[model samples]
Target: MASILMLTAATRRERNDATSFVFDAINACGGWIEDVHMYSNKMTTVRLALPGTAIEDLIGSLIDGGIAVDPPEAPASSDDRERRVTLQLTFLHDEPDLMRDIPAIPG
Candidate 1:
């Protein structure tokens, strides 16, 4: 299977459960959380490595859970089905330059 990449938009810079909510959504979408990176706790992008799960479902759950976001951008095709893929749950608020800490998926 081809790995997927996504970017979710956040509404604010601060919130108590914003991070937790995202995690919960991921779990509900069949993603097993091996590790989590909280970039800013309540402000910044979160990179995830969800395997065998559809990101579209995760986005829907996040929005229904009160975290509205834009559709995930174009995904790069890959043959590395077993590679650990990363997903970016970013709190960009539309600022493109805010993308900085997204971990590179090594080739």
Candidate 2:
């Protein structure tokens, strides 16, 4: 069965290069991209379709390529028919925790 996979990634490299790298990894695993959205020059989100069983292989390939991806999260709904997966990829030293620099307000 085919499933929809959404992946978000942030990189310091040029947007085109990052997109190509992601597309290459997905294509290497036999997956095809359906849609792509760029939130910023450094961030992109891609929607793709692939066999439900091949998700693991795709993640493995990305990790092997030196991209750090967060663990896939289960669908928020409890419905058993949901077949979508979302993953976030972070390029080493590219994404910083800006919130850490924000000071907390007095309670």
lDDT of 2 by residue, 10-98 (tens): 44554466567778977776667776655444455677765565677777776665566666654222333324554454443455433
Pairs of colliding residues, candidate 1: none
10 residues in a row with least lDDT, candidate 1: 76-85
Off by over 4 Å in 2: 1-14, 75-107
Worst 10 residues of 2 by lDDT: 74-83
Best by the lDDT measure: 2
- The lDDT, on a scale of 0 to 1, for candidate 1 is 0.56
List where candidate 1 sits over 4 angstroms from the true fold. 1-4, 39-42, 51-53, 75-107
RMSD of 1: 9.3
Deviation from native of the Cα of residue 99 in model 2, angstroms: 24
